[model samples]
Target: MDWITHDEDVWFDFRGSSPEQLTPGRFYKGTVDGFADFGVFVDLAPGVTGLLHRSELDRRLESLDWESGDTVFVQVKNVRSNGNIDLGWSIRQSESEFRGAHVHDPDGDEDGERIEADDGGPEPVRKTPKGISTESRATNGTESGDELSADATAEQKRVEAEHDETRESEAETVEPAETVSAEPDVVEATTSDESAGVEQSAESHEAEGTPERAAAEDADEGTEAEETAERTEGPAAEPERVTVESLGDRTGDRVRIEGEVVGARQTGGPTIFEVRDETAVVDCAAFVEAGVRAYPEIGEGDVVRLDGEVELRRGELQIETEELTELVDEAADAVEQRLVDALSAKARPETVEPLADHDAVAAVTEQITDAAEAIRAAVLQSRPIVVRHAATADGYVAGAAIERAVLPLIRDEHSRADAEYHFFTRRPLDDPVYGMDAATNDVTRMLQDNERHDEKLPLVVLVGVGGTTDSLDGLGLLGVYDASRVVVDADAVDTEVVEEASVLVSPSLTDTGAADLSTGALGANLAAAVNADVTDDLSHLPAVSYWEDTPEAYRDIAGGVGYDERRTRELREAIALEAYYQSYQDKRELITDLLFEDGGGLAGHVSQQFRKKLDDEVATAKANVEARTVDDVDVAVLDADSYSHRFDFPPTSLLADTLSRRDDSAVTVVYATDELFVRTDADIDVRAVAGAASEAVPEGGVTAVGVRQNRIEFLSGARETVVDAVVDAVVAQI
Candidate 1:
C-alpha cells in the first residue's frame, strides 16, 4: 500500500552534524538521551542535544514511551546565541513519513533529491543530491557567484563527469517509476535523475548569465511548492483504537480511546477531561485556544470517542486530544455496560472481617462492612473522599488509618500519578463535632470545585465526630447538597445521629461496653475492612489510642507488630502533641511515620515534649485545687481559666482527666470562664447533670457539648451559678 507523505518538506538526518548546523522549522532525527520532569532530552549528534519542553509536547512528560537510545523526530524550534537549543515535538516520527530525507550541513542546505510519484500524486520539490558538493555549485556560478581556483575547478569537473557516467549507467537499468514503487531506499535512488535534471537547468541559467531570469524562476518554484503542499494536506490516517490501561505503552503515538467523561477541568492552556473506561481513568487534554474550553458540547458523564496522542507530562499520562466525538444510542450503551460490569467487580471488597475479637467491634460488623464498601465504591466511581475527624490523638490515628488504606487503592485504580492526593482528603476538626462551621467550609469548597471544574460531589466522612446532637445541623447541611455521609465513632451517639448519617458505625448502638472502645480502635478495624490488604499495617493502631487501659488483644497485637509498651506510649504521646499544634491539618506523612514507621526514633523526641507539657500543666493545676464535700462525696474544684494555659498544650479536658487520675476525690470539676469539664469515678450521667445545670440557671444558656467527655458550656456571666448547679447535680446522681 502507498502511504501518504509530506509533499514539500524533507526530514534532516543529523547523525554527522553539530548544533549550529540545525535549521529552525526543519525536522531532525534524534535519539532520546534522557527524561526530566519538564521534558525529554534528545541528542541530535554527539554532544549536540536539545530540550523538548513539556509545554511543547502534546501530552504530559511522564506519559512518553521513549527510552534512552530510542530514535525520535523533533523540529529545531530555536537555537539561542548562548548555545541553548529549544526543540518542538514533531507529528511525524519516522523518515518514511517525509517525501525525502537529507543530511544536514552547516554551510548551506545539502538537500536530498526528491522522487516524483508515478501514482499521479503531487511531485516533491527537486534539490541537489548529497554527492554534489557546494564547491561544484560555486564553479557553476549558482552559489556565492565566485570563481574557483584552477585546480579546484578541474577537481569539480572530474567528480561531476564521474557522477554523470554513474547516473546514466544506472538510469538505463532502473526505471524511475519502478524505483518509486519499491522500498524507501529504492525511492531515494529514483531521485538521481531529478538531481541531474536540476543540475542541467542550473548550468543553462549560468550560460545565459541572466541573474533576473534565475530569481524569477526560483519564485515560480516557491509558488508551485506552496500549491503542492496545499493539495497534499488533508485528513490524517485513523489512529489505532486502544484502552486507557494501554496508554502507557503507546505514548507519543496517535490513538483513539472510548470512555465516559467523569470530570472536566479548564486550565490556563487546555481543558482536561478525566475519562474513565473499564480498566482505569486517564486525563485527556483538549485545547481550542489558550484559556478556552475545547469540545464545549461534550461534558461530564458523556460517552465519548476521542482521538489523540498519548503524552507524559510531569510524570503523569495525558492525552493531547485531536478530535473528541460524543457517542450516542447503541454505541454509548455498549461502553456504559462495559464500565458498569467492571465497576461491580472492582468496587466491593470480597469480604469484611473485624480485625479483633471484641464485643464492641462485633456489635457493628455489618455497619463497618457497609461503610467500607461505600468508601471503595466512591474510589471506583472517581468521587472524592473528605474525611473529617476530631483533632486528637485517637482522631488523627483514625483518619490516618483510613488514609493509609485508601491511598494505595487510589494509586492502583487511577492512571494519574497524583490521584491519591486529588481523590482523598483528611481534614481535622477542632472538636469532636461536625458542626455548622466545619460543614459550611466543606460546602463552600465542594461547591466551588463543582462549579469551576465540574467535579463530582465528594463523600463526606466523619470519624470520631458527627455522632452527637451537636453535629445534626452540620450533617443536615451536607445532606441538603445530596452529598453522601458516613459517621464512625466509638462513643454512644444520640439516636437522632443514626438517622442523619448515611452509614453509622458505633458499637454503642448494640453493646453497653462501647465506652471502652476508642475511635482509633474502630478506625483501624474499619480501615482494615475498607482495604484488607493493609490489615497487617493496622495491627498496632488500636493500642496507640488507649492511654490508660488498653485491651489485652490490642496490646498483644501491638507487641506482635514490634510496638512494645514504651514504643506504643511514645507513638501515642507524639501523635497527641502533633495533633494539638496543627489541629486542622491532616499531617498525614508525619503521623504515618510516627504510627507505622520510624521505629520509635521520631516518636521518642516528640513524646518527650508531650510529657513535659502535660506534667507542667498538671503541677500548676494541683497547687490551686479547692477541696470540698458535697452530699458525702469528695470533690476537687479548680478554676481552670486561672490555673491553666487557655490556648496552649494540654487542653482543659486533658488537664482535668490528669488531675482526676491523681486525686482521691470522687468527682473533679475543672471550670473555665464559659465551659466546665467534669471527671468522676461515679456512674453519674453527664448529660443529665448538664440538663439540671441548665434548669437551675435557666438564664445561663447552659448546654452539654460533649457528653462522652462530660463537657458543658454555659453563659460566662452565670459561671459561678452554673458550676454550683453542675457539682450539685453530679453529687445527687452519684
Candidate 2:
C-alpha cells in the first residue's frame, strides 16, 4: 500500500468532499438516517455517511429521542475500505449548544471552512486513511505509535486495496494525477465501491445535482458577461437565498426570496407588495417608473420569486426589489405547499378551557380563538392595532385589557422603545355601535398616517361595540380599504355583523338572551389568549367591569388573584369618572396604572368623586322625574331638556340609568321636546315605539333614529302630546 504525508495546513483545508475524501477528526451536522442494534446511522451529506456507535454515547442509546430526520452533531472517527464510516459521540446533542458548528462541506461556500477551534490550539491526532497520513515531528525527541489504533491501520490497508482496483478500472480515461476544479487544491481519490454503504448512493446523487449546477453556472456566466459589458465590475455575485425573517442580519446586502403576495398597493413612486413566506412577511418595493406599476399582473396570493436588497425604512425592514418573476406550475405548487406546512403548525387552539367556564362563553370559544389569532397576526405583520370602544366604564376596562396585552407584545417584538405608542392606540367612542362619525375619524387618521409616513393600514378592533347591523355602514367603509376588523362584544350581535367582521366574539350569537356576559370578560379572555404572558394581569378586569351582582366565578377568580369586590368596585368607579371627563380621550396609561399597579389611593380618590357626582345627579333626577301608571305598565318619563343635564358630565343615558334605578318603575324613558332616550329592563323595541308614535301622532313631526341607541325624535310643538303618545305606545307594546 502506498503511504503519503501532508502538512497540517493541507489537512486543515480538506473537509467532506466525496465518499472517499470524508476526513476524520472533524465535526459535522448530520441527519439521523436510521437506527440499528449496534448504533445509529448518520447521513452527513448526499454521498457521506457515518455510524455513531452506541458505546461512545454519554447516555444510554435507548434514551435518545431522535427520529429519522432529526439533526445531530457527530465527529468523524475513521473510514474503512468497504466504505464503512465510523462516527464518535458528541457531548452536545443540539447544534445551538456548540460553537462554530457548521455544515462541513469541502465544495461549499468559500468561507465555510473558516470555523475557529474553541481553544486556539491544535486538536488531538486522529488516524487518517492510507496514503493520507499527516506526519508530525515529536517535540520530546521520541516517536510513539499510541496515536494509531489497531482498527485504523487495518481499515487504511483495505481502503488502499479498493483504491488500486478503482484506478485500474478508470485507467482508460483518468490521468496519473487528476484534480477536481471545484476544489482545485484537493487530491481526487478514486474508489470502486459504487454501491457504497453510505445512506444515499453517490452515483444517483451526482446525477441529480449535475444538471442543476450546470444550468446555474451557465446562467451565472451569462449574467457576468452582460454585467462586464455594462460596467467595470462584473455582475454582483448571486445573492444569498434566505427567508424574510433572516433579513434582519442581511440589511444592506442583496438577497433572493420566494413568497406569496399577501398584500400589494401603489404609492407615488413605488409599488409595494407584502410578501409573506413561511417564516415572516416583508414589504418589497419596486420602482419601475414614477407613478407606474412595477408588476401589473401580480396580485394577492400569487407566488413569486424576488431578488432584492434588504433596507431599514422608517424603523421597519423592507426589500428593494431588483428582479421579480411569478412562479408557475411545479414551482408555484411547491411554494404553496411550504406555506401550508407552516400554517399547519399554527393550528387553532384545541380548547379554551380556563376561559370557558360559563356555558355562554364556552359556546363562542371558536370565535374567540379566531379573534386572538387575528390580533397576534397583526402584531407579527407590524401593523398597528387600533381599538375603538364606547366611553363607558365597561368599555374602558375591556379596551384597557387588550391594550395591556398588546403593548407588551409590541415591546418584545420590536426594538424601538416607543413602538407601543406607535403600534397600539385606543380611542373612546361616544357610544356603542361604531357610528359613521367614529369610523370617519379613524379612516381619516389612518389615511393620513399611510400617506405621510408610509404606514401599513391599521387593524381596527372594536370592543364593547360594533356587534349590531346598525354599524354596517361604518364597517363597510373600512372594508373598502381592505382594513381588517375584529369585533368583541357581549351584546346580542346580528347575524350579518358576525359574517362581515373578520372575527366576532360574542356569546349572544350562539344563543338568544345570552347577553348578560360583560365585554370586559370577553376581552380579558381574549387578551389572555392573544399574549399568554399577560393572562394573570388581566384576570381581574372581568370582575371590575360589573358595577353590581358580579358573577360568582369571576368574583372568585378576581379575589383569588388579589382583587376583592371592594377593589373591583373602586376600579369601576375610577374608570367611569375618567371615561366621562374628556369623553374622547382613551387615557391609556392612567387606566393601566389604576388597574394593574399597587396601591388603591388613585382608585379610592376617583371613586369618592364618582359617588358624589352620581348621587347629586340621581337625587335631582329622582325629585323631578314624573311617574304615572299608563295601561298597567308603570312608566317613568323625564323631560331631560327641562330638568336634567344634557351637555354636562352626567350624559342623558347615565341620567336615565339613575332614574330607572331610583324609581320602582317597570319602564323609564327620558327625552327632550324633540329627542327621546329610553332605558328599561322590560322586553321592548324602542324602534317600534318610535314607529307607533309617528303613526299615532301623524301631525307631530316624529322620527325613529339610532335604533341601537334606543333613541327617537319628535316636534317641539307636540311635546306634551308626543310624550303622552310615546308613553301610550310603549305601554300598549309591553
Candidate 3:
C-alpha cells in the first residue's frame, strides 16, 4: 500500500506547559477553555491559551459544537510579542486523522524529534518549539568549553526538584479521580493522564485551596458525558422555546427561539438579524468580526432556530446569538405557517370607517380599506414603502398624515433602531402626475437595492397624484416590474387609472361629490385604517389641508385636538413655504416637528417667512398685470417670466391661484417662457383648453401637464402664439 503526507496531516504535542513552548504554523491539540463575545479560548497546555476568533472559523461562532475542556484541533497562526496566541480553525478534529505526530520537549533539544509514520510513510519534517533551556542543551564537547555559573546550576537543580515533587504528588492522586467529586470545589478529571496533569498544575497555583479550577474541570467533564450520552441515547431534551414578545421577561437568560428572518443588516460591530415570530419582532446580533457578515448562508425570509441570551441594549431588547440554525422541511413550514396566520390577523383593520361624515369619503370607504390593508401588509413583510405626493401644502399634509401613522408601526414591527428610515420614505413630486421621470428613478433605486442588499421592491403609494391619464404610462412602468402601487387622490381621476392602480381611492371614480373632499382628508382616514393607534394625532390634518371653506366636522376635530383655526392656518402656511423651498425632499423630521410637535412655536416662526416671501412676490406681479376682456369676461394675464421672480418663492401655479383670489369672478393666467398656469372660480377643464390651444396652434406643441393644478406646457419658439391660443381657449370654456 502507498502512503501520502500533507502539512495538515501532522499534529504537534507540546510536553512543556508554557507559552514559549508553542510554535506557529503547526497544528496542535487544544482544550476548549471558554467562550467570549468575539471568539473561543483554547488551551494548548496548562496556563498557555490561544484565541480562535470567530472570523477564523468555518461557521458562525455560535454554531461551534466544542464545549469547555473538550479537545479541539487548531492551527497556531501567530504568537504576539505580548504572549498572546492567535489560532485558526482545522478541518481534522481527531488524532487518528493525522499521518504523523511529533513530541516537542522545551528543555531537551533544539529541534524536537518527529515520531515515524505508523504505516511506513515518508519521514515527516522536524521543527523545534521555542524556549529550549541553554543549561539542558549544553555539551562537554563544545570548542569554547563554556560552563554554567554556580548560581545558574543551583537554580536549575531547584527547579528540577520541584517538578519531581509535583509529579509524584500528581501520581498519588491519579487513582482517586472519582473521589474528587465529593469536594464541590474540585472537578474530576476524565482520564488518569489528564487527572495527573490537572492536579500537578492546580497544586502549583498560589490559590490552591480555591475550587475555581476544579469547578472548571468538572464542567468540561460533564459536557463530555452529556455529548456521549446524546450520541448513544438519541438526543438530549431541547431548551424551552420562547416568543419574541416574551423576550423582555427573559433578559439575560439563554433562550431558544424560532422565527422568520425579516431582515438582515451588517453594522460596524455585528451583523443584525431582524427575526419575526408569531407575536413580535426582535433583533438578534451575531458577531464574527468588525464589519463582517456573521452567517453568509442565513438571510431574509429564512426560517431559523436561534439560541441566544436576551439583553436590553440602549432601552431596546436585543438577543446576543449563541447558535443559529436554518430550518427546513416540516419545521420551516410550521414556523412559516404560524407567522402567516398572525400576520393576516394583524395586518388588516377589521373596519375602516370614514374619519368624517362626507358623501365623497363614504363613497370611497372600501377602496380606502384596501389601500390601508396593503400598506399595513407591506410593513409586516418588511417591504420598503415609497410615498410620492405633490409638493404643495395639501399634498404635504396628505403625505405627512400617512408618515405619522406608519413610522410608529415600523418601529414596533422591526428590531433595528433605524428601521423607520430604512423601510418608509416620502418623496415630494414637482408635478402632480406620476410621470416617467419619477417612475424611472424609483425603479432604478429599487432594482439596485434588490440586487445589492436583497431587499424587496418597495410599495409605491401615490398620494394626491397618479390618478389621471397623464400618470398611466408611469404607473404602467411600475406594473412591468410587478411593484405595488396605491393611488389616493381627491381630484378627478381618469377611468383608465382604475385598471392601472393596485388600489385606487378617489371620489371622482366613485361618482360622488368631491367638492368638499381634500387629499389630506382621504390620506388621514387611510392612515387611521393603517394604524388606529395614531388616529388622535391625525384628526387635524384634513382641516390643515384646506385653505378655505374648511368643513365644520374637520374644524371641530382639529379644535378637539387643540389645533384651533389660527394654529391650523399657521401650520398650513409654514408647511406650504417649506414645501416650496425643497420641493423634492421629504424633510421628514422638520415636517413631523411642525405638524405633531413643538406646540405651534416652529410653525409660527416659519409662517412669518411664508407671509414675507408671498407678499413680496405678489407685490412684484401686481404692478405688471396686463388686463384683457375676452367675450365680456375679465381676464388678467401676467408675463410671469418677465414680471415675477421665476426661480424664487410662489411657483407659477401657486401665484396664479393666489392672484385669482383677488377677483373671484375673473380668470388669472400666468404665462412663463414655455408653460402657463390658469386659476379661476369658474368651472373650466384645463385639459380641454390645452387641447383647443393645440389645435389652434398646431406647431406650438401645447399640452396640459396637470389638470388638477391647471398647468400647460408648450414649445418655446411658439410661446407668443401658444399664449394667445391658451387665453382664447380659457375664455371659450368659461
Candidate 4:
C-alpha cells in the first residue's frame, strides 16, 4: 500500500477500496499523476483518479506550473457512469487555503485515523492492563488489511473508547460509559508506568502536583465520559433535524441542523462556519477558548450534523453551536444528496426559448445559460449581487428588469425583511465602460465589508455596459479578490472582454448583430431565465426601451399584457426622468413602483413632467440650431453653451436625442464650451472624429470623452475650427 503524508499529523493510504467515499462537488488534494493533450490525470486516491480538462483551466493549459508527482488541488465536477471522474481547476493550490481537508477513506480501521504502514523497524511501545509493554509484533507485521494481534486489538478498543468519551463530553447529554467500571483501569496503569520511567513516582506527587498526577486527572475525565456514552447508547433519542430556513422560528430554542460546510472564517472571538442546507444558508459560530479552531477536521463541502441554539447576534441570525458532529454513512449521504439536488435545480433554468425569439438572443444561447447559472449560483451561495448599467432609458429598463426578477426570489428565500437590500444592489453608470471610478468605489466597499463584517465579496454584474475592453481594468480589479463577474449586453464587444468575465452574453460572439436588439429585451430574457415567475411582468420592458423603430414582436408582447403605446411611453418617460434625477442610484423601489405597480397614477404624473421638461428643452434647442446642408446631409448644430438650458430640466443627451428624431437634422451636434454631443441616423465613431479634428486643427484640444454617448470635448476658444474640422471629418467618414 502506498501512502501520502500531509504534514506530521495526517497520512492517507492511496490503496483504494470503496468508490462511494469520492463524491462530486467536493474538493480534493491530488498528485499530478500524468498529463495528455486534452487534460491532466490526478490521482485523488490510488483507484480514484480524475481528469482535469484543459478547457477548465483559468490560464492556458501549457502555462500550468505543475509537473507529474506534484501535489495540486482540484474539484470533482462530475462522476461519470463508467466510473471515471471529471475535475475542475481550483485556484487554491494548498491545504491551508481550504477550511477542512481530509483523506476520506471509509476502510480505515480506527475511524480513518491518520496512520502509516509499518516498515522494517523496532516495534513501538504498546499499553497493557498492568504496564507499558515494549512489545514487537514483527512476526505478524506482514499480515495485511489492518490485522491486529490480541494486544493490538485491546489497544484499538481503548482508542475507540477514548473517542466515544470525547463525543459524550461534547454532546453533554449522554450517560456515562459503564465500561469504565467493567474494564480494569488499564489507561491509568499505562500512564503511571510512562511517568515512572521519568522517575516522577507517585510519592513525588504527594507534596506538589507532578506530571503523573496531571496525566491521571486527564485520564479520569476521559474515564468518566467513556462510562457515560457506554451506559446511554440505546435509550437516547435522536435530536429533531431542522433546516436553516426553520431557524428563524427556532430562535432561543435548541435544534439539530444537517448541512454542508460551504465556508469557514475565523474572527477574533469565534470561528464562523457558513452552513447551507437545501432550504437556505446561515452562519453558525463556534467559540472554543477564543481564537482557536473549533472543529479543525471539518472542511468546506463536508456534510455534518450540528446541534446549536439559534440566536440573534448583531441584528443577524446566527447559530451558537453546542455539539458539531462530522457525519458518515446514512446521515452524511442524505445531506449530500439533498444539497446536490437543490443546487442542480437552482443552477439551470428550464427554458431559454422565450428569450431566443430574436436571432441575436438565440445566437448567444450558451452565454445566456452560463449567465443564468452564475446568477443562480450567486443567489444560492448567498453572495451579494451588484448590477451596474448605463444611465440611459434602455439601460435603466434593462437593469430594472433584472431587479424585478431577482428581488422576489430573494424575498422568498430569506426570512429577514431586509434581505433584498443586503443581497441585491443596482447602480447606474454614466459611461458604458466600467472604468476606474466605478472600480475604486466597488473595491473600497467590498474590502471594508470583508474586513469589518466577514462578508463575502459580491458578484458584480454588468448589464448594457461592461461589454467593452475599456472596462477590463475594473473587471480585473474585482478578479484580484476572486469576485465573480457576468456581462449581458446587446452591443458588439471585444473578445478580451468576453474572456475576462466569468460569464458573458453577447450576440457578436456568434456572428450576429445586436444593433436592433434592445438591452431591455436581452435583460428581460435573462431575467426570465433567472426567475421565470417574472417573465410576464418583464415582457413589456423590451418595447418600452425603443422610442423609435420599436420591434413588432415586442410591441405585440406589450400589447398582449395591456400595455398600449401610451402606457409604454409613459413608463419609459417616467423611468428616464427618474434615471436623470438619480443618475447614480439604481432607484429600485421608485422604478419598481413605476413599472410593476398598479394604476397608482405615479408613472402618469412623472411622464407628464418628463414630456413638459423635454418638450420645452427640445423646442428651445430646435430654434437655436444652425441648420445647414453639409454635402447633402441635414446637420443641426446647437451652441449648447448659450441657447440650451445646461443646468435645467431635460439633459443635453435627451435634448439631442429628441431633436435628432424630429426633421431638424439628419445629424444633431450639441456643442457646449468644452463638450459636444452627436446623434445621427447612421453609426459614427465620435472618437474617430475627435482624433481627426485634433490632427487637422491641433490647437483645438479636441478629444472623445464618452464612447457610449458619442460625445467629444474641445477647447472653447477653438470652437469654430474644432466644429468645422469635426464636421469635415464626419462627412469624410460617412
lDDT of each residue in 329-436, candidate 3, tens digit only: 987898899888877787778998677787888888888888988899899787999999999999999999999989988887554578899999999999988999
- Candidate order, lDDT descending: 3, 1, 4, 2
Clashing pairs in 4: 100-299, 175-228, 176-227, 176-228, 177-226, 177-227, 177-228, 177-230
| lDDT for position 584 in model 2 | 90
Tens digit of lDDT per residue, candidate 1, span 1-734? 64454523666766443556677888877766444333455667654667676567774343455655567788988775534467889876665666666666555455443344223222232343212223323445333334655554453345346434532110011111111111111011122322211100000001011122222223234344445655797545566667676666666887777789887765423457878877667777664322245678889999988777776644456676666788889878988998888776776677777777778998888889889888988988878999999888888889999998999988866656678888899999877888899999999999998887677899998998899888999999999999999999898788999888998898888845597899999999999988899999999899999988999889998899898899889998999899888788888888878887786779999999999999999999999999989989999999989998999998888889889999999999999999999999788778799889888999988899866678899999999999999999999998
Output the better candidate (1/4) by lDDT.
1
Q: Is candidate 2 or candidate 4 better by lDDT?
A: 4
Q: What TM-score should be assigned to candidate 2?
A: 0.61
Model 4 stretches with alpha carbons more than 4 Å out: 1-272, 277-345
lDDT of each: 0.74, 0.67, 0.75, 0.68
lDDT of 4 by residue, 1-734 (tens): 54453433332333443345665666666766444333455666643556675556785443465655566777777665545566787876654554433555566654445433223211221322111111312234443314434554454346446434531111112221121111111111122321221100010001011112222223334443446665878453334666565555565776677788867765323456778877666777664422245678887768877766666543456776666777778867877888878777767887775643678887877778778888877777667899999888899888988888888877765555788999899999977679889988999998998777656789999997887767888889888888899989887777888668888888766777787888888888889888888888888889989888887888888889889999999988988888888689877778888888847389899999999988888887777889878898877788887887788767787777788888546777888887788888677877788899999999988988656677788888999888888877787677
- lDDT tens digits, residue span 603-702, model 2: 9999899888888877877788888898777888888888867777577877777677778898888887587777677777877787888888887887
* Model 2 stretches with alpha carbons more than 4 Å out: 1-241, 244-255, 260-276, 281-351, 354-356, 699-709, 715-717
Between candidates 1 and 2, which one is better according to lDDT? Answer: 1
Candidate 4's TM-score reads 0.62
Q: Which lDDT value does model 4 have at 730? A: 80
lDDT of 4: 0.68
